[model samples]
Target: MTDSSPLDDNAFSHIMADPALAGSACSLAVACSGGPDSMALAFLLSRWCRDNGRRLTALVVDHRLRQESAREAETVGARLAALGVRVAILVREGPKLTRDLQNQARLARYGLMLSWCREQGAGDLFLGHHLDDQAETFLLRLARGSGVDGLSAMSPIEMRGGIRLVRPLLDIPKTRLVATLEQAGQAFVQDPSNLSDHFTRNRLRRLMPTLAEEGMDARRLADTAKHLSRARQSLEFYTSQHLNRSGRLYPHGFVRLERATFLEAPEEIRLRSLSKLVSALGGADYPPRFDRLQRLMKRLEADADGAGTLSGCQLLVRGGRIWLAREPSAVSGPVPLEGVGSFIWDRRFRIMLSATKKWPKETDFFIGALGIDGWRQWQNSGREISGFSILPAFVRRGIPALWRGDKLVCPLSTQKSDHWQDHGIEEIHLIAGELFGKTAFSSLNMRTM
Candidate 1:
């Protein structure tokens, strides 16, 4: 192989010279896993720091999945320390093997790394993902039939979890990194799990080369990812502007432009707008699929009396106006209120006891669950409370009882009294439904959730 050490130095200098990296006095924290790619990154950053008079730190995260992870972390730390770079080792302790566990571990790894960087006064975290990783990601997303945002793959730089993540080595090839490590006599730990066919990423990496024989290459794939990223960014910008201009917020929900506004924009822009609105209200986790979004949008235009639900929010077409409402909790059972305790009636409604001393007088709703002593006292005073008392049979069977003042109120299913209604009891804000229509919901769900 060509002398990889010189090539590593050249690549490092090139990245530092990039306009994106210039003018930031931010200290750099290289995420070193002791893998060849990360080791190469550590070496490059160390050299760059010495030349540019910038501070560099190597962060080694031990996921502790393997028996040797702690050893590996120490070995990597020593290697970086030998290069005159400060080293910080982070150990992540967690569950094993399962997909969910792996994801949780990944999150913990980044969280710990970023937290350490923040504590050390570092502003940027440098990752060591190379062009091959990007290309593999794009192919995997494409295979899943993801939309523009998914196809965009990993970004060169992204702000995540309050830390700026910069992939300075994305343009370089993994082979080149390995070669550099070999030339530098770097002893990097190889994670055997990477070669396991059981992982989807590994499967994709294995297949990419065979598929590349049909004229695919990392450079071209990376370029496609870059293009998709730009397109996704532009669409997001347009959607935000459209919502700000035409969206109206109500006490319980918000409405985007009337049907006319959606019909005016191009299909892509309209879909993007709808996705944004749904995401804003439902939280990022709620995203409806594309076909569902398209069907909902068509229904809005063609079926004047149509209504649909997506992402746990409901969309209603009434008399020319579109209304989005949160779905009421589906739990139909009654909850017996007893003294002060936290009760989750439906999966949605949660009630807890607050001190009467601190209770606000102007509160909209109050449901009382008093013990016998309190009930007898209120009863002697002749307090007027609404609703029937818990059935004697239910009380006998230890079924939950609801009480208002001294009187027994209806079961948990009963609606609160008018006095409670006037206090902001009846209206609950549901996340806004997709008003930009079906396509937007679909695209947003694919990438975000």
Candidate 2:
């Protein structure tokens, strides 16, 4: 590791100047693990928050993967608390997974931390992912034959679950973080797992030295990632413009694309636009395989009046418009809605219960898709079906519905007449995560040197 100087407030102050962060309140949160990197971040944020007259909280997540994990969490809390930083210890409790332990742990950690941020009214979350982490991620993705977007590595800023995840240390090296801690005479813990070769990252870490001997180093790899990031940014900017010009996202969780507008775009833009539409409407965490996307594009060009399905979404072209809607067969099975609180069902709808209202104690409610059976019942009952006549029959059947046993209680629709006053429903929003209408593609330019 190269000798580096300790970081100061100036290293983090520029993050506050971002216009995207202007909407956030005067409170910030940081993820700390009691390690040199996170510990240094927590200390730096503590002083910065104090000087800026803002509130800061350090969140430590206990994955409970090891026997000492819980105690380690408390130890992290103590260290942050001693630095005059508020600390919250979040525990991940559930059955342990035997496969993909590291990936599972990461998902669980973010789940707990983001939930806490929403509860505490913190809009921005700071993470200590330094240059080495970005370099490792680049090499890993490159090995996997990832495209430009994946190989661009991590961003300095990202929006997750409506929270701004800020990584101000992406340009800083791990040695600088260690130096920062040593300059302040602070003690930090090292995670033993980092040294184990069982994990893919640790294996890559070992190879880094050998690769550096041949003129491939961390700084060079990270710089290549930044260069690719700019190219990715340009592609995303044009893709966003194409999506906005060619499609309309309906409140009923469907998209209508102008047939000619969609087909006329360049091949790359068309693939990207289709990928975004499917991922958002299908609520899939990742985009479909590139080959699958390419194949689907070819089919769309061949068949003007055909239907195809991918990533839990159905794409159909009829009457010169391409209709993208949720695949009814792929809809999540019924989920029990037991309490008077907000819940996200099927990752596509948000159902918020009225805290002031209570339901009958003897009844149980469930949220599921308005399948053909539910639509038949609604139609047979002579309930104003004309209000939903504008939407396609298949699209209407896939919308969210409330059920009491087998009886359909409410079918959420785009019509203005639907209400849940009797059931104490406060609000329902179509919240397909990262859907076309919900968000546009964005990027920020960052200098690594």
Candidate 3:
């Protein structure tokens, strides 16, 4: 590849077109730092996006770990602004960084950037992960004994939340990025952490030269990863087929697994299916660890009726089938109604709380799960559920309930639409989490390798 392909307008256009991502979004949001690689990307994208009539938003996340971080972000923003690109500095607000600083910093960076992209209605997000990063990731996942997906390293495009995260320079070498900066007479900051021996990645980078001398170069590794990525895509196709047939999706935020048919599938397919389900309901990025997942699979394979909890979700086997539900303790906490309108509670339910009064105050009501105490109140109200006893128990603690004072108000089970039940106005609907449909299994798409 030519040196300009990493940042040239024609190259950028080709990358977007070849990947079929040009039509996926109308605007581009780039995660940029003042580093050589990201600055090169920002410089290229700024011109490319403008030429294509696409708006560009560059986000600089100040992780706030070091005192100099804010200054760095400001400098980066100023430089990008000079290039006629819109820049936003997002300061990560979190507790003091201690252990696992790299992981924490990463999560903060992506979380802030992705949130900003979503808020701006930006459908495409770009990052500056190069071929070197891909090679390091392959080594890391190889060391961890990861499956094909892990060994696949990074994809050209990944769908996160509602955004398509694009990596345009993944095939470009780091030297090229620096050369691009040099050619443009642009300056970039060098993070001190990169040279630190304390970080695993730094250690790995130090080892790469020796490994390359032994004939394990970055291109060879990245090529291997690309091959594995294709194989991984094949497995995903079958996995999707299995998911569609293995379980009955319920509109009430749960699923009914046809246990026998699920167990009949091959081991790999079975594992993948279960992992996707747990991740979807648990609202976690990755499934449980391999050991934990294996143990759960063993129990399920025995075909014995039983129940267990893992990854913040409950799996109960009854009458030769499985019922999957979210653990109440794991769901989101109380979200204040604020007023009368539709709002998502814990991402598990879309609650519509209409007030009986024409106007409602902020202190008027709160929404949360119906725990044991709420259950007692529900029983004392002289009510009984006549059907689907197991279903009610599954969501009882987590069923959205609106309360003004000590009164039970309206829980998911209550049919009465009056008094506190009305939430001061109209009826209350306790919708399930899966009502909007569970997203595809992208949790394992971590850049571990």
Candidate 4:
């Protein structure tokens, strides 16, 4: 932890040596906020890229919440440039101040950064959250009575859509980053918002010293986070394995799982298994609340049907199988397919369409908008309108396609539906919501063909 040596250099080298990154020339994007921790990360990553012949990009997100945010990003960009890192600055503008502004700002910031990484073809994005931050996050989650995953705080690596997010300095100390930055003659901007008591994190930081006095060292908290992370990873792995073995996709836009199998596992495993089952069925927007999950589990053990609904997803236990279903939204209606607009497909998905006279070449499945009419015409010819009457009217818009597999297929809901027989080229792009109860779709990694 010498001041003269870059603390993050060791970390960056170690991460590069990881089997995940070994021998592969991948572009790396660093999320820098002009803070000491991030600045040190950018400097070290820049040097590592230079030595390893890998491209490095630095991203600074200006939340635009504070008046000085733009200038701070510029200063951070200048500092990164001095360290030989290419920098990209993104400014997020929105309401100046409001309830939950911090959370909104965070979403916007990450949204801009991740979107930039995708657009730039970066394989991985690096963040500079250190041990102290992990400890703080753990404590906060603990105080809020979070589950194992929440208690796990931050993960070292996470896969979103197609981007791999890696935090190489999670084991390092914030003090070490500050010392390294100081020794490097780097001047980092101290965000005044961090010191303000307006945020829960700030309050936790203020209380950390007292908590540490009670024999809870920040290092110990960091260790706790690591332990939780390991435990969570194990639980998730087991859950995935079990789900693959026991879960089945059924018609009627529901996924079914054996209730007995889930109930027979250990409580933790049971909870995780159920959660994962619901998540897989719901897509990215279905995070089961702990209380709701507990209740659901109890009902599953009972003979009667017990159901829970959250964020437009429904979980029901019936006839020894648990079914997860997405609710149809009142917003379902046909709108003109003039150009690009977001159409809510039930509650679990939104379809975004960008139409052009000439085929707009990009990733995502595309089909003729009139294909639905063709299907109707075929149904009329075959006298199959009776069964087909139950089907929702398909509006002509842009071709339906996910960001993966350059094939025009039916919407995910249609694929999940029981009566979805035709896989024709329908001019509708299905933008599925977060499968878990996460609010933002930006966290998802969109694959390009």
TM-score of each: 0.57, 0.76, 0.76, 0.67
Clashes of each: 8, 0, 7, 18
lDDT of 4 by residue, 53-116 (tens): 8899999998877777788789889988888889999987666756797777777877787778
C-alpha displacement of 87 in model 1, angstroms? 1.7
Stretches > 4 Å off in candidate 4: 1-5, 8-11, 21-25, 207-214, 249-267, 277-288, 292-449
Model 1, range 278-382, lDDT digits (tens) per residue? 444332233567887777777766876667666655566655555553332211234433333343322223344433323344432344323344345445656
**Selected candidate, larger lDDT, 3 vs 4:** 3
Model 3 stretches with alpha carbons more than 4 Å out: 1-6, 23-28, 52-55, 115-122, 161-163, 209-215, 333-392, 396-449
| Model 3 lDDT tens row, 222-247 | 99999999998878677766766666
Report residue 398 deviation for candidate 2 (angstroms).
Answer: 4.1
Clashing pairs in 2: none
> Which candidate has the top score in lDDT?
2
Task: Arrange candidates by TM-score, descending.
Answer: 2, 3, 4, 1
Weakest 10 consecutive residues of candidate 3 by summed lDDT: 440-449
Ten-residue stretch with the least lDDT total in model 2: 440-449
Q: How does model 2 score by TM-score?
A: 0.76
Off by over 4 Å in 1: 1-6, 23-25, 100-102, 243-449
Tens digit of per-residue lDDT, candidate 2, span 1-449: 55498886776667555665433457789999899988988888788789778899999999888888899999889888889999999999899756888898888888898878866668788888988899999989988999899999998877665466888787888999999999888889999989999899999999988988987888889999999999988997788788767776665677788888889899999999999888777756557889898999998888878888899889888888898888887777887665577766665666787788765555577778888888877777777544465666778778788787998886875343344556767777765333443345222101100
